[model samples]
Target: MKLILKNIGLLKQAEITLYPLCVIAGENDNGKSTVGKIVFCIIKAINRYKEDLQESKEYQVNEILQEIYFKFRRALPTDDGQIPDVLRQLRAITTGPANLPEQLATVREALEQLEQSGTETRSTRQDIMDALEQIQLITDQPEDTRQSIENAFNKVFASEFDASLLLQGAKTGTIRLYDGDFLLIHLEVNAASGATLKGDVDPINIKDVTFIDSPLILNHHDLLIRSQSMLDVDRKPGRSLGRSYTTLHTKDLFDKLKEPALPNDLFATRNKALLGNIQKLIAGEISYDKSSRDFVFTKNAKSISIKNTASGIKVFGLLQILLANEVISKNTMLILDEPENHLHPKWQLHLARILVELIKEGIYVLVSSHSPYMIEALKRYADRADLKDTSRFYLAENRTIEDRNRLGEIFDVLTEPFETFRQMDAEDLRDE
Candidate 1:
C-alpha cells in the first residue's frame, strides 16, 4: 500500500512508495520514525478495537465478526428493519440458523401479546436476553462498556515502543504525498512544568488526522526514551538500583536473521510462511520473561539490562512485532519510512532481499528513504533481467516527488558505459 502524508509532524509533505523490500534512508532527524508511526497508526486503526495486537487470533476473530455484523446490519430492510436485525442477531446467537424474517415474526408476536394484555414486555425482554446469552458470537453488552475487553484490546494492539516521545503535529501548509496508507503510532510532547506528556499541548482538530483506513495510535510519557526519566525506571524495574547498562537484555539480530522461526501461532494464525520470511528479513528475535513487563532484545537477556544497539535494529524489531501476523493477509499495506537507518551495508542488502520476496508474493510495500545504499540495492535487484516488474522507486527531496521514470531518463543521459560494455569482447570480460 502507498502512504501519503500531509501537514503531519515534521513532514511538511512527504510521500514514500513501499516496495516489498523498501528502505527509508536520509540524514538524522529527517522524520523516519514519523513515517513508521503513520504506517503503524493505520494498522492500529484497522485492528484498533481488537483485544489483541494486529497479530492475535482473538483480535482477528473480533475483526471478522465486526465486519459480518456490519454487513448484516446493512442488509436489513426498511421500516421495522432495526428491530428485526436485533432480534435476528440475538436469535442467531441463541438458536443457530434462524432467519431474520422468522426471528422478526416471533418478536412481533410477543409484542402484540403484550400490547393486547396492556402489560409491560418485561417477560418478553427477558426472553430476548436469554436468547442473546445463548448466542455463540460476541457478548450481548455494548462494546464500549466492556473495560476488560477494551484493555485487552489496547494491550494487544499497542506497538512495542516508547511511544510517549512522539510529539504533536505542527500546523503547516498542506502537501499531499502518495495516496497510500498511513499509520499513527504515537502522540506526545513535553509540558511547561518540565513534564513530558501524552497528546497535543493544544487542541487540534482530530478530523485533521486522517488515514485511508484505521491506523494504530500509541501514547507514551515523554521521558520514556530518555535515560533520566522515571518512565525508564518503570520500563526496567530492576535497573532502578545500580546496574551495569552493558548487562541489559539484548539480542543478536544478525543471528536471528540467519535462523528464522515460524511465528508464534498466536501471531501468525493465518499465513505462517509469510511470517517466516519476515522473521528472516529482519532476523526476528525478542526478549521477555515473567519478571519483565515487555520484551527486550534477546542478546542482553537481563531484567535490569542496559546495552546499546543501533536505532535501526530497534526500529526493525518494533516493526517485526507490529507486522508479525500482517503478511498472511492480502489487503494489508505495509508502509515504512527510512528502514535503512542505523543498518550496516550487509543488513541493508539483506532487508532488500526480503522486500523483493514479499513483493513477489503479492504484498504491497511502501517506503520512503534517502539512503543511496538502499537505493543502489533496489536498483541492482530491479536491473536484474529475471526480476519481476513490480519494483518502482520514488525520490522525495527538494519538496517534490521525482518518479523512477525521471531517474530512468537520467540514467539514459549518463549512459556512456553501454559502449564500454559492448566494446569489451567476451574473452576480455571472462578474463576479468
Candidate 2:
C-alpha cells in the first residue's frame, strides 16, 4: 500500500509506500503521526462504512419508537394500573437494526390492533398511525466516498473540518492512497470548501486499524465506559463534537482491550507463544482488577496498581493484553507511534523483534520512531527472519524518498546527541 499526503498538518507533501511492516523514521514535529492519522481516517472510513450506517439507523429508529410510545400513552390509558394488552404486546421489540423495517412493521401492526380493539377514538388512533408513516427509516446512502471519509474524520478528530488544518499559505490540500497504480482513495481539502473524497469503499481487507500513540492511555481508560464501538460514543445526540485534547483512537484501544479475550483456536500456538514472551518480559501479568476497579500488574503473587510500575511495563503490558484479547490479527492494521519512547535499549530491540515477527505472520504494522537502536534492531531482525523482502522503510521529510541508501541521514538526525556527547570528551564533562 502507498500513501500520498499534501498540506495536511505539518507535512507539506509526503509519498510513503507501506510494506507488510514499514518503519518510518523522522525527527519530532515532522508529521510522522500526521501521516498515520490520515491513513487511519481513510481506512477506518472505508472499513466501517456499513457498521456506522447501521448505528445511525438504529439511533434514528429508537427515536421514532420513543415518540410513538409517548403518543400511545397520551392517546389511550387504561383506568387502572394496566398497560393495555395491545401496548403490552408492542413492549417486546427485540429486533436487530438490520431488520429495522420489520421492527417498524411490527409496531404498525400493534397500532392497527389498537384501532380494532376500540381503546381510543378514530382521531387519536389516526394521529398515532400518522407518525409511523412520517418516520424516516432509511439510512442516508453513501453513494460517494466523500461522505464516508468526512464522517470518519469528524469523529476521529473530534472537530469540525476547516481551513485551519491546512498548511500555512496553502489554499488547498489532498491525501491520496493507492495500490500501486490503482487509486483507492482521494481526499481534497481547501480553505474555501472543506474536504471531499472519492473511492471504492467497502469492508476492505482491513476491517479496523488501531493507532497507539502512547501507553499513557491506560491512565484515563475509564473516561468512556462500556463503549461497544467508536460510533457508540461519537454519535451521541447533543454532545459537543469539539473534543479539545483527545482523539477517539485512544478510546478505541480501550474498547479493544476490554473485549472478551478471544477463545482458543485463534492463532492458538503462534500468538500464545508471543503473549508468553511479552508477559515474561514484564515479569508479570497486567489485568483489570474488578475487585479494585483498577488495572494491576501482578508478579510473583504480588500485585500493584499499574501506576506504580515502570512506563516500560505499561508498554509491554498493553501488548500482552491486546494479544490475550485476540485483537491483534492479520486483518487489523496497527499504527504505532514512537513505541521506543519509554523502553530500554534492550527491550526496544525485543519490541522490534516482536513487531517484525508480527509482519511475518501477515499482520501489517506501521511504526514511527527516532531510536537508532529500535531502527537497527528492526532492520537486523527483518534480515534474520528472512522477511526483509516484506518490509519497507521511509524517511518522513517534506519530500519523500525510499531512504534505504540514505539511512545515514536519518540516523544522523536521530543520533546527533550521541555524536555531540562523544565530541565533548572529558574536558566538556568537567566544565559542566
Candidate 3:
C-alpha cells in the first residue's frame, strides 16, 4: 500500500509507502498522524459506503415522519396527552425495518385524509405536502461516496483539519492512496473551494484500520462507548454533534471491544498465539470483566482493575485485549501513535520486537513515535525475523523521507538528547 500527500498541513509533499511494518519518527505537530488518519478515513468510508447512503435516506425519511407526527399531535386533544394512531404508526415505522417507499405512500394517503377531515389549516397541509417532496429527492439518486468520505475525513481531522493548508504558496493539495495499481482514495483540495474527492475506492482490499492513539483510551471507555452507540443509531448530517476534537478513533475501539469475537478459525488461532505473547510480556492477561463492565489484569490467579495497573502494563494490555478479541486480523492495519508514551525504555524495546513479530503474523503495522529505543528495537527484530525488507522507516520533519537506510537517520534525530547530554558533560569536565 502507498499513500501520497501533497501540501497537507505542515507536510508539503510526502509519498509514503506502507510496508508490513512501517515506522515514521518525527517531531511533534509535523502531521505524522495525518497519514494514519487518512488511511482510517478512507477505509471507513469505503466499508460503510452502503450504510451511509441508507442512513442518509433514513434520516431524510425520519424528518418527514417527524413532521407528520407533529402535525397530528397539534390537532389531537391535549388533555389526555395520548399519541394519535397515525403518530404511533409513524413511530413504529422508524423503530423497525421499514419499507420506506410503501411507508411514504401510506403517509401521503394519511396526510390527504387529514386534509379532507378539515382539521389542518391549508397552510399546515401544504407544509406537510412540501416535506414529502424530500422523500422523492432522497430516494431518487444515491448519496455520493466521495462526499461521504470527504465529510468523514474532515471529522476525523477535527481541529487539525484544513484541506487547503498549502505551503510554498501552493494553490492546491491532495491526498491519495493506492494498493499496487488500484486507487482506493483520491482527495483533491483547491485553495478556494475547500476540498473535493474524485477516485475509485477499492472496497475489498482493506478489511479495516484501527488507530490506537493511546492506551489511556481504556480509562474513557464508558463515555466513548456510550457516545459511539448514539452515533451509530442517529448521527446528524453535520459535525455539530461532536466535540472540537475527533472521537472516532477512541469511540471505534471502545465500541469494537463490546462486539463478539471473530470465528475461531486458523486466523483466530494465529491471533490467539500473538495474544499469548503479549500476556507473557506483561506477565499477566488483560480481560474484560462483564459483571463490573471494566477491564482487569489477571496474574497469579488474581484480577486487578486496570486503573490500578501500571501504565506500561496497560500498553501491552491494550494489545492483549485487541488480539484476544480478534480485532487485529491479517487484513487489518493497526496504527499506533507514540505507543512508547508511558512505557519504560526496556518495555519500549520489547514492544517494538512484539510489533515486528506481529507483522510477521500477516498484520500491517504503522507506528509513529519519538522513541529511538523503540525504532532501533523494531529494526533489530525485523531483521532477525527476516522481515527487514518489508519493514519501512521514515523521518518526518520539514518533509517526509521514504527509505529504509534512513532508519539510522531517524535514530540520530531521536537521540539528539544523548548528544546534548554528552556536550553538557564535556563542558562540566572543562570547568573541573
Highest lDDT: give the candidate number: 3
**Of 2 and 3, which scores higher on TM-score?**
2
lDDT of each: 0.41, 0.70, 0.72
**Candidate number of the best TM-score:** 2
Clashes of each: 51, 0, 0
- Give me the runs in candidate 2 sitting further than 4 Å from their true place: 81-102, 116-119, 134-150, 157-165, 199-204, 224-234, 239-245, 261-270, 290-292, 398-405, 426-432
Task: Please give the distance, in angstroms, between residue 174's alpha carbon in candidate 2 and its true position after superposition.
Answer: 0.7
Residue 48, candidate 2: C-alpha displacement in angstroms:
0.4
Candidate 2: TM-score?
Answer: 0.85
lDDT of 1 by residue, 1-432 (tens): 345555443454565554444444444455545665555433433344343322233333333333434433343333544455353553453234424345445444544544554544565445544443443343332344233233332332232223222234443222122333343222222222211112212211111111111111111111222222232243334555642221001111121221233233325445455556655554544432224333444432232221243454554454454445243235445554556655777877766665555556555566656556666776686566245455655433433333343444434423546666777876598898
lDDT of 2 by residue, 1-432 (tens): 678878877778788776777788877877777777776766666766656656766666667676776666666557577777656545555423346566677677777766665776777677666666655524444344457556765554433122356767888888777777778777777667666655543234676788888877676655545333334456765544543334557666777765654322223545878887777778877776656666778888888888888888998878777777667777778889999988999999989988887777777888888899999998899899897787777777653434253466778778889777888886688899
lDDT value for model 1:
0.41
Ranking by TM-score: 2, 3, 1
lDDT of 3 by residue, 315-372 (tens): 8877776777778878788999898889999999889888877787788999988888
Q: Which scores better on TM-score, 1 or 2?
A: 2
Evaluated at residue 107, the lDDT of candidate 2 is 74
By summed lDDT, the worst window of 10 consecutive residues in model 2 runs over 261-270
Candidate 3 all-Cα RMSD: 4.4
Clashes of 1: 51
